[model samples]
Target chain A: MSTGAKKRIMREYGECMSDTPPGMKITFDEQNMTEWEILLDGPEQSVYAGGHFKLKLTFPNEYPFKPPVVSFKTKIYHPNVSNDDKGSMCLGLLRPEEWKPPNKVVAVLRLIQTLLIEPNPDDAIEPSIANEYKENRKEFDKTAKDWVKRYAK
Target chain B: MDPAGQHRDMMYCHECHDEWYRDEHGLTCPECGSDFTEIIEEDHDPRDHDDDDDDSMPDLEDHHPQHPLHHHDPFQPADDPEEGDISRLQWRQVGPGRFSVTGTVYRTVSPHGQGRDDGGANALGGFASILNNMIGGAARGQPAPEDAVHRFSYTSSARLAPRDAINPQAHMEPVDEMTNVLVGLMATFGEAPGGPNAQHPHGHPPHANGPGGGQMPFHPILALLNGMRPGNGTMGDFVYSQEGLDRIISQLMEQTQSSNAPGPASQQEIDALVRKPVTTEMLGSEGRADCSICMEEVNIGEEVTELPCHHWFHHPCVAAWLAEHDTCPHCRQGISKHERPSNTADGNTGASGVNNHGQMPGSFAMGDGPANDATLVQENWENSGSSQQDSSSGGIGDRIRRGLFGPPHR
Candidate 1:
């Protein structure tokens, strides 16, 4: 929580404010800017079109040096996101080694939107979901849509 | 044998070498009045375990697996030993089964010495092999136990001094003290190098010092002990091959990076980076941009460091990140091996307002397609939802979608 880290978080917040991702709304608190609550409406091209999903983005003390953590609070049924209480997504730039300091929250939001459009089954945290997505696309779609209705409504 | 119901707890004074049962006198040693006294918890002396027939060498058998001397693969790569695990004992191969150990002394008198301290164990192994050779490789016609440290459980009771408290003056005394301890260990553990009764200071059965054998066995040990003394470079570097040692050291350092994070860059590398003031081209279209590291707006004339990749940030800002990792914060290209001017033309892309977030597709690679900045996508939606923008950067937004998922699945 150095001043540099705080200033960076504040600046990222300002940038995220002006250009929030499509179908997404960000809620920020001045007191605890480290944790951001995001409300996302599932995109039209994806299976979860009508679903409203709540997500949490938490920044570590290392800030740009380390990647921000992204978790699904609304428990979406997806291959890349973990299927548990943590609901963490650790693939792509979300990974510590893959993350770069110049990458912004807008890029992260875009990644999430892109992931929803077509989940990356190859680098998946949920193997069963990935297997279903690869081997039985119909079943994966049915279950994903069903969960979006059940939890994300 | 005092009173049947009376508890007998023996106490030994490390300073004066006085032994008395604790019940008769308090913690203070009545003989020497030294506060440096240890309560010897075990009733039977450690030497008592030694007298138990050599046929049952259970103690050595129990601890042999953990000992470094019994290491299955000496040349196999190993992680750096934990700090303070062992001090300066180096095992150099002299012949088939022999090793000449060389280093300035290690004392295992502290409580932390309970676990795998390789120095003391190695010294014991050295003694075991040397004794095994001298006694015709057989203990009075029986094959000797390979490691004899089991007979001496004194590692627990030897409270000479804590490791941190050892003064320079006390250094010489420990070698002499360790010599006596080793001598006692040789007598108790091995086939008595000085005959059975010679070492028993309490004067037990077989009577003391039969002949010249008393001092004869001690010469080699004294020489070995003298070699172990601090600043004793007389032994020289016993390692036969420098390449083999270097390989081992390098392997140790490699294994030390067990975690995914790479080590920090040198300060000189961070210092040598080129610096320049913010210019109009370095700022966004609105003439405003921030150092991504510190996220502070870089006004014109404000100093910034330009990495080898031409991606720049506040001097202190980039330096901090480089200290933790050498790679450019924008591109993952390492500062040490950056491709010269390959992408320098597009390097100002970081300050190029809308597209800065779109660049650095390399950082987002994870089998799936890389992340493209959403600002372009937002612009295309604003321009017209379905019609593609004819601009080159606008064309990238359509490519971003196709790249993210397979070409236009919908």
Candidate 2:
């Protein structure tokens, strides 16, 4: 029996393929449903605007029940995202307790967009960006946009 | 990635083509005595991202942020100076029993630009405007409070149908457009999305997809419970009746009681959660801290539950949350990640004992069954064994060689 996840994922895939979310495009092997490569366009209003960020979303077998592991594939300067080999962004809903099984990949995509627009300094993975974001807005925006141009582009 | 696979602890051996639970059995292939094996974490395809590396990537550690002041450990000096509110949560009660929970949630979707101004405004905006004519239901002993009443009963379809059915708000809310599409798949298989509720393992496909909505499944029990009401008094009336409330309370109590058993989270595991007494310093300088559930500010000294993953939340919020699921709300990493294997005595379940009808519990006879599956193996063994026997068996050839060289060495 394909659990709720299999059917739900197919539905998500169809909807996303049919109506791609703003600034987000997903590509996955038809046979391999669990791992998907997402091409994310930076929010227009943000410093990272005009950049296309590459991200990989990998769902566990117990998806919905468990949050998908989303990581940045393209390098970009963001406060919430870890700038490392892992490139894992510490988003909240993907957090175990916050992850309602009903939540979809679409919501996660929305979250990434929101994070790009307004990075939270409190729970930042990259504190320097957060500090700069809090104390020096100009430098932060310039560096973020610079990284967007240099790497995310 | 193998989406269907649940167990991440599996290690596949190439030499013998055997699979071992890496958690139970250490990193060796027991059957063939080989060390070559690949670790698979829940069957996710080995990451292709590891291959791509750009040297231009900035120096990460130098740019990384650090939380230096008041690391927020459960045990800290109580007399620490409070800091500014850095958490992006603004809890504003719009009306009685209704409020817009706006915050920079882990995954969020609120119209942007509400900004930090709402906090100062909400503090002074309550009291006189706390719903001037508050609904008289569930008054909670206090004639009225300055703020809006927030009491509520959480219900799912698995519990009851009737009076709650009249509740347009409750029941059969599709999770998303995708859930609607999946419902079509379920319908093709002929399963009613929620007929008889919990009995349907792979849920009864919700018949009404409508156009779009949250796809949280509706339990069929909602109808059955409502059907039990006397006469044809309508499902709406019965849903709001005291009996309905009683039923919901009883269900809630039963669920809470069940938590003592090995449910989503074990009692011991839940107990291990850090009971950090809410303090001023933890909330920072602003006296507003975000709870894991509501994403609202928790008051100082309000006890919170901290998961092993280090995510903390209001005690009540986390209690209600943990009742449904086990993992830490924020990290998805298990609050109780280390689930003790049931049968630790015989962790190594070998390929040989897989088909045996009544084998000993821990006795996994290795290298017996799979090794003998083909006749080609016997032929090869016989051929190699005979050839080795002729040279090193030391029967006649070794004796002659020893006789010729007997006095030579001396």
Candidate 3:
């Protein structure tokens, strides 16, 4: 009955999951107060298509005041995500400016989904991947798809 | 003179101006009344010594004898009748009229005449020797002749006589002695003494016959009798008696006991002593809206937990609140877990919605509890695995693993 930010987030998650895509889910860690995991389906026709990318969201004690750390658990190749690690997406939702106390878990999840569709090469976590995407988009897509299929299920 | 007047005048003496008789040759002066002696002069021849009148013959050669006695009748001058000439053997009248006579006694060559050849030096020496002996005796602490005179004769005479010798009534008994003998004598003559009861003389008793009459109380006797009684208890034996000592000790004990007994505890009415409820202004200073555990606005009358960090919240809220976190809900400053139930692990778990019946997180509520929880679990699992792998590979494996694994997979 006492609804704080975490309660509101849980409520919003249940509401959002009612219309969620098949095989994709988001839930909070049972043991931890601030960690969350999300299973996302790769968008159709993209290099990550047919892949299930897992992402971990870890919030600090000062939640909403500061952004959570979002990283991918499924391997992928992208300019904004490190290819050496599994699905390590570096998104703006986790950025200091984009985070505010009013921003909810649903909003953060939506932001992560948007990052999957269009990764920002300008503020990329992997510079080599960003360069490959800039010089040869075809080769970058190919490497990203192959890694997603190999690591992400 | 008229005969009667002359007779009256003849009755008074000339010297005394009183009546007197003058039948003899001696006449008395009327004012001074002194008897005058008749004067007579005799002629003496140098060869008139007669054996029959040896006593009347003068020793002319030894004119200055050791003891010379002269006799003269009253009011008559000495028979010698010498003049005032220092060189001649003459008598001079020194007293008034002819009462005294004096003449040239003698002339001495030297007062101390030991001998003519010694020039009186021996005599002077003898006198000095006697004076020295007297002074030396005194200096040596010897008793002077005057010391015996003072101790014996003079002191014996100076000693006071007994009272009986000095007091007229000392022979009579003190209690029976009459104070006024004259009054007693008058009573004996059938005349009553003048006093308050003198008019009722027959009805009155004798003056010294009443109880304690004419006899004063003896001060020393009264003092001795008063001292014999135990009224003051000043006597050494009375003061040190067991009964007196016990009473004193008991009195002292009673005084001490009464003084030491604690006074009664006054009824302290519970009015201002009771604590008042915390106000909104007291809670609002920390910028906290509601109780962190209950998620309810802390009311004015509600008791609250106050942390040393100047944060306040409802008592139950903070107790359940601090159990989840070991710091202030608003400020995140460290607070002891033992201080509140909320700070303990159980309370924290319950407040974090870990219980079967999920409750909303208080101040530490996160966005999307399920999603946040899944993320935390995945991250922890991956971090734990990576750390284990890194440790198994040794120090060099950490850098190589970081180059291979990059940031934690999650």
Candidate 4:
């Protein structure tokens, strides 16, 4: 990593440790400085209320300048989240052009929490789920809760 | 002036090369339904003439509306091509006859918008018409009037009247679009017995359009830009848009800004940095072995500059840094105490004096070297805080005092 990136990462790591987000915990990989493990318990108000989801965030050498890559390791059913082996979650803020230097991992965690609470059905990667959420809200909640109970227990 | 039987607007289909009334089929051709219909206004549409002589057209469909069977009004005015989208119309017809065909090498470099409606009074006189006809010559680069460009897309095309066709000579004004085009071409390529184009400026043409002809006529470029690129056009015709003009200018500004930021360091500044010949004996256990900037080990017999902060680096590397910042890259220590201007030198004193809880200026400047005038300045710099008040010309001692106390306020 470049000196600027390394210094900023250490600073960001220090800041994130000081104040962890609500219902979320951040843990760094012992050997790799760039990789971080986030254990996120779904908000009580959301569909996946009692679910515990594990997520991985790997930052490039140019953090702040380049946005980190976020993917769900735990199985989940949601719109905007791609249903694939990569389990990549696409957020507007995480886009390369939109990612700013000042945004930290805590901000990303907050966005992910709010995204689960109020899913955007319009710009969805999983169009089937988005359609279900829009047209039939009851069926979408039932399917989402079922997936959380089966896989994210 | 007779409106009846005049072809107001015509759509020329690119696929079938058929003309249509825009009001009937809209933007596309009715026969082919092709949207690539170039708006055209023919004076006496040859199709209208072809209808008069049925032998000229081989139409198998007896009930075709375009035929005399389903007779339509020919004199109806054509709808505006750019009616809904006026901003979509990129170029404006400046004064006509500005853009002349310079041989076959015709190219427009930039856009200009001026004198758009002013040129119709002196319009295309005969002498200018002769020059408009002359084409085959080497063309020079000229500033294109930005008032309009590629204007042939959306303009009121003059359709031929039945009366004008019967008596063509009666309405053949020098400024007429047809005569402007014909005379411009004649002035451009018509190098014959009465080669008015080749001889008008040289006063070699006949008496009618001689030296005392009319006002010097504008070229076809300014007079009639429609003659430049006559063809079928779509919505994307205006490529050099006004919005694109700003992008070109911003790119130019960015190029100049980057050039000024890091002006190449002068050779003399590189040679003048306080340096010492590197030796194996000087490698102290307390000091770092490698240069922080390049991260290279200090080789024996190589010259090095140990800054006032006790941090040593390669002479080439540190001198290159000091030329711009005048500070140590690793420790943020001052390289030269009095090198900068009175204002910035005061700022540096702020950093140096406050480095260790804002106590000592002596330890910063006189780190490892022998005592000199620099040491004496640091000794009294603290007491003589207002150096300007102490002396009229501001002596070294008074300046040193200002430097000492300047850090606290900063």
Candidate 5:
């Protein structure tokens, strides 16, 4: 890549990944400029505790004009996330109208962290879990914690 | 000396004048010497000539039966008896060419018992008699007046003669029957002075001043009570007996009135609601370590192009995906192939990098090339200043300087 484009990419990458919360880590893959890896610890007091979740972030050539696509590499249980082993967190902030060019990488990471703390049931990708949570919270939390301990690690 | 006689003679005959004068076709009056063309043009009355021919018409003076100015011998007047002693008036020969008539007159008595014997009373009596005649005629099914004025006045002013004047007893029976029906109707629906249950032989509580006391006896509560097993007290009585249902209803009512209870869902509650297990398919293509397109392990050997907006598909997969939609499916970031140019000369001025066709190429194709020349020049421009500077300038300057120092340190 040309120096100017490389620099621009690095600058944006640095901004996006700048502030890692205490238990989270984010890094670009060694061999590629566009590939990134992120690690997150379950939020305290949440059913997702004791879990280490991994995520993959990929960027297009257009950089800041578009948002990076993120998907979980770890298996995790969440109502707002899709019901696949691949962690597909359904978040509104990552949507086009919600994303800003000036939004730093760290802000997005923190947003993910906050998501772990409070998932949005209104935008549930896993409707079954959402329904269970609505009908019976005790059973939902127990199942969620069991899954997190068994697989998210 | 007679005005009417003089006027009749002065009226000339146009036809006679035309016959006497020159045999011209036009009409002319001999007496007035004026053109009578207008009068002759109209349909002339043949009756006028018929009257002239019958000069021996009856002595009109003798035909004036009620002329006030004519004298009649009292004995002869009494002796001139007509049917019902009613004399019909005749047309009077008032002058050589004029005629007049008078009507029968009768005395009338007022409702206040004052007798009016003069012609005024007679006129009034005549009108009253005509009215009575009409009523009697109508009662008997006789033909009434056809003249517009007479018909309107007779219909509007005529009253049915008193029952005494007609058959007196015919009116009494109906009035008695009507009075009986009205009394029965008033009694049937009337509220009992004491209470409604007064007639119920079984002693029940007098109907309470509750909702259906007087006017609306068929109110819903009353209906429900009526439907209840007769021995069972009314619904109101049953409600008073059930404590639990009433409490429940009261609670519901209170809850509705307050309207301040916390909503069913809160952010924390929602977050808790979504705590469930997610599977691989839910993550979509991005979650797959292997590229479906190339059918190879995605993270391992396959050469993958990652979009700057942070979405990874195999290079070929993304290329195909970009061909269809310019935005990333996951993040919805617009991933058009055309980059907005820094300068307008490059023709990408708007925030939306769409071309004139409003189509934006996918992200994979956005840049001119991965290593375009202009970008190289701009990098060179930025680097030159930094590389030539020292640590004293700034952290960025030192970094650039060190970068230019390059492989030596590595």
Candidate 6:
């Protein structure tokens, strides 16, 4: 990473430290500052209430120019999150084309919280899960809550 | 038999043409020690049934005329045709889901039987129908015929169809026309012409004989066809052992997606953006803000490049991003060259480089310009959203959603 990208990441880390999003703890390592481990508490309004989800946010060499990659380290039964081991999230601004250099890591954290509150079934990564969320809300919520207890506890 | 207490099968070594009992000598040839040996089934051996050997042999030949034992040379004719050479369009499944077609020309002394003619006719009909469906669809801008879809679905099974089912001489009447049509059809769905999408596997650049639109460029299909010498006759008969039509169509479909994706901004557009110093009036309420690109605080008097959309960033920062995409980083408004500078900015529009530094004629032209700029930015964001919806949704939320699903559901 360039000095500019590294400086930006450091500044963003400082900003996140001063004012981290509610129920989220960001751990930044100076040795490898590009990758940050985040512990996110599932929103109270959502089906995954009381569950703790671990997420990894890794900045690219392009840093602010290119959007950071976000992946679910803890399994979450959500429409937007992948069902596989990677648990990758790639919707919206995460897309290389849609991502703007102006976008901040704070906005990304807030977006994740917003998604947790209400998963966007329309742009879901897991179609079956999205379908369940749309067609069978009860089943979707039940399974999501069950997974929260089983995997995210 | 000495140790395993089982009967030993007879094995033949193809390398040395030697036979041995497996229990005594194993699978390897006992004489030459070659491992290229096959187990000879006791019941399948011709020498085992000598009583009615002639009758069984003739029946076997009748059933499998193209068998390696019957016709050692692929170029040798199975049956004699009266006149010129018969060109059989040979289609082979070169790999999993990839089929390559070649013409194999051969001659025979005497005319063949009605059975062979009937088989040839059937194969010809199947091939003709497939070609007709594809050509007819392309001409009318309609979906390919249902029969072609069915044939493509069963290509794997069709690959195992009797070799006699591929005799191409029965429909020699339309040889010239069919050859042209074959060439045309292959070109229509082949590689794209002279662009990033062009991928010629055999290093043969696209040929110019496209009977269809410019969208169709002659490809490896033509290269494969040209490689063959359909001997002594213009008869270009066709047989698809495994249909590659679907594969080609799917590839074309795949190309169309990326073909529409927004390309990088040209150099001229990137250089045209205005460079202005950071001002408190521009910063407004907070009186402090970071350049979103580099996340460094841009205090008053610091130089920053301002995009036509009114969103400003560090010159190097926005320039690097603009090289990859044309849209404003904040609002995604394309700094399209088509955008005309407003009449109000005419006083500042001298040819001198410093005169154009005020702002581009977009949101800055409004009567309530600075206050209304936020709303204009918001509206531009929505415009960008709707435009991106065609390719993919924008916003970190929608991007995450779209990214999860991959490609529009369409």
* Candidate No. with top DockQ: 6
Model 1 residue runs over 4 Å out of place are B1-262, B337-410
Better of 2 and 6 by TM-score: 6
TM-score of each: 0.45, 0.31, 0.28, 0.32, 0.28, 0.48
True-structure lDDT of candidate 5: 0.38
What C-alpha lDDT do the candidate models reach, one value each? 0.55, 0.46, 0.38, 0.46, 0.38, 0.55
Worst 10 residues of 3 chain B by lDDT: B147-156
Interface RMSD of 4: 20.0
Model 6, A80-105: lDDT tens digits are: 89999999887666766556675567
Write the residue-wise lDDT of candidate 1 on B177-272 in tens digits. 323333333433333434343343334343332221222222333423332332222222212245644554445434533322334668987888
Alpha carbon lDDT at B275, candidate 5: 20
Cα lDDT of model 4 by residue, B102-124, tens digit:
12212121222222222321222
Off by over 4 Å in 2: A1-3, B1-410
Q: What are the clashing pairs of model 1?
A: none
| Model 2, C-alpha of B154: deviation from truth (Å) | 43
Evaluate residue B344 in candidate 2 and report its C-alpha lDDT on the 0 to 100 scale. 26
lDDT of 3 by residue, B84-197 (tens): 211222223322221111112111222212222221223322322332343242111111011000100000001111111001211222111111221222222122233223
TM-score of chain B of each: 0.25, 0.19, 0.15, 0.23, 0.13, 0.31
Write model 5 residue lDDT over B318-373, tens digit each, in one string: 45434433433222223332322212212323422222111112211222222232
TM-score of chain A of 6: 0.98
The top-ranked prediction according to TM-score is: 6
lDDT of 1 by residue, A1-153 (tens): 788988878877776787677799999988898999999999999998999989999999888778899999998999988999998987666677556676667777878888999888866789899999999999999999999999999
Predicted candidate 6 versus true structure: per-residue lDDT over B195-309, tens digit per residue? 2234345566534422222222223344225422221222133334334544543454345433222456788878877888877655533445556677666778988888764
Measured by TM-score, how close is model 1 to the native structure? 0.45
Error of 5 at B82 (Å): 76
